[model samples]
Target: MSENPYSYVESELPRLLGNSSVSGVYKNKPEDFEVIEVLGFSPEVVEKGQQHWLRIRKVGVNTAAIEKQLSRALKIHPRDIGYSGMKDRMAVTEQWFSVQLPALQSMDWPAWFAEHMHAEVFPGGQVTLLEAVRSHRKLRRGVHKANHFRLRLKAVENADDLTQRVQQLVAGGAVANYFGPQRFGKHGDNVGQAMRMIQGEFQVRDRKLRSILLSSVRSFLFNQYLAQRIQSNLPYVNEGDVLILEGSQSYFTVSADDKDIVERVQSGDVHVSGPMFGEAPSPAKGRPAELEQHVLDQFPALYEGLCAARMGHERRPLWLRISDLALTWPEETVAELSFTLPAGAFATSVLAELGQFTEGEHANSTE
Candidate 1:
């Protein structure tokens, strides 16, 4: 690991298929990037339940602020409001929020929004109610299956080459699933804060902020491990590797003699995983375990702090597969791209592999 574990360039993440030469400007305006949540369950499942779920389209607002507003408007504690995941503040995003209304309390949502849907409610941002339904359960974080993105890239060059790169990515069946810049916070201050906190040089009393900082530390270690694998030209899965099944959180360790694991990896049934350091014993063995240990060895303080904090062990995939990728040229200088990624994956990770963008701020703008 380097002196700054979290300072590596996003483009340095090994491209699974190869690199692309395309260049463009991303998110030139709020309307340029759009995200729609894909709730895996049907609305009818919760129609007769006590929870009221509202699907909202918000522009230039983050999830926390919207949750706060909902709490005040409903005259309930903040904990009474639930959301699946946080959406980006700068993009146009549609997501679901669940409110735990009393069993006997039922109000017309349209009339409710009519009176409370003003600047006073969402002070710095704007939100519109798209749909309202009843659900039996609150929308917990990470409940959504995936997020579909529609983005417009401006001043693009070599449009034909970009198309070829997308094809290669699809055929190769993987893209390096490095935690995007967003995980590290603006200017990557979270990583620095985590290092300080681990060293006892800084203290974060807020549980939420502390959790986020610790996550940044874990993400740094994961990226470092993945970067080394990419640098070594290692295959996605190795003997004795722990592999995560596609579309599931469950994982299993591969035996040294298991030759079919590679086939399973190539067929998109499983993926090679990197560690999210915590208290649990490492599930990996042999070279994979050795590789992970090497990375953690560079950040002893972070490793010790994580152990002391008693965080649970977890694994994240090293590669992400883009689904329903489509490209269209809205103008000679503009390109539109749409794709769907698993809930925890970042859309910017896909863009990083495509090429360098002129407007670099868009790198971490995804929800």
Candidate 2:
């Protein structure tokens, strides 16, 4: 394949605002980068609850480890705990977690955790329980509405130019929704490993790790299709492209000859989506399907492997919109950015467009 799934080239994606050489240091400290998960659903009050939901603010700890700690402290199975999404351990993140606690067996949670699971109890003061409340249901993965980020960039250069570029990006209404490096394991070896598995040269015995590898394979293919779209710079759609309505999973196929479809794409009411390869032929038709097929054809082994594994098809938007994008200069050498993205989107994808930077050690550590 022409594309290298292991490496990301920001230049491959067309920058809505022109490019810049502005450089900065990211995530110098855990507190410098913060994220708050936006849970769209309100917790339904339960008169007698079987589940307890927690809002936790954690630093230097991954979600799984926190779940393990919660399990230990509560004397419950790890599977009994749930979270909406995984948060990066290198940054300060506030998110929700749920525990199944039968009413008859309930303990004084606040007092019990305060004594056994306080910050001092964890090494390096990594995890903290901010609040606990009764919930009628568990917090499930991918249920969050969005993630709000507060990022600090240090030793930034060309501050004025960077601000202009950011404004242009906001005005453009879409950013390339490339999967960040975190999707691929350390140094992006996951893609290679996945390819080996597909070729029958390797086997992944662990179910969770195997799932992650498979996801990496699919994401790599999606990124390839997206990169080609950006590189082509074609009005974001081709004849017989699959188009998805904004904020909805519903989609329909339309040819480029259709005027209404063209208008919808240009007006930002809908987006052109690319294939997440699977067991069957892509739902897209005509030129769009051809483009996708060409990319998949380059990786025959991967395509066959995914089909053999019975991976199902899906589509992701070619672009993402940034909501409430704001930037401030805290110092001549520092810039702070805050914005919200739909759940499953990456903050790094937005940052890549702003400027070049040395990624923090924790940047790719999130699972």
Question: CA lDDT, every prediction?
Answer: 0.82, 0.80
Rate residue 299 of model 1 by lDDT.
Answer: 76
- Tens-place lDDT digits, model 1, residues 1-367: 3456556457666766566788998877678889999988766555458889899999877788788777887899988888888888778899999899887777699888778876566666688889998878877888899999998998888888888877776666567898887788876667788878888897889999999988888888888888787777765678778899888889999996787888898788988898999989889988889888988888778888889889888999888878898888879988888999989898888888787764536434534
What candidate 1 gets wrong by more than 4 Å, as runs, is 1-3, 44-48, 358-367
* Model 2 bad stretches (over 4 Å): 1-18, 256-258, 262-268, 361-364
- Give RMSD (Å) of candidate 2 vs. truth: 2.5
lDDT comparing candidate 2 with the true structure: 0.80
TM-score of 1: 0.93
Q: Candidate 2, clashing residue pairs?
A: none
Candidate No. with top TM-score: 1
Please give each candidate's TM-score: 0.93, 0.92
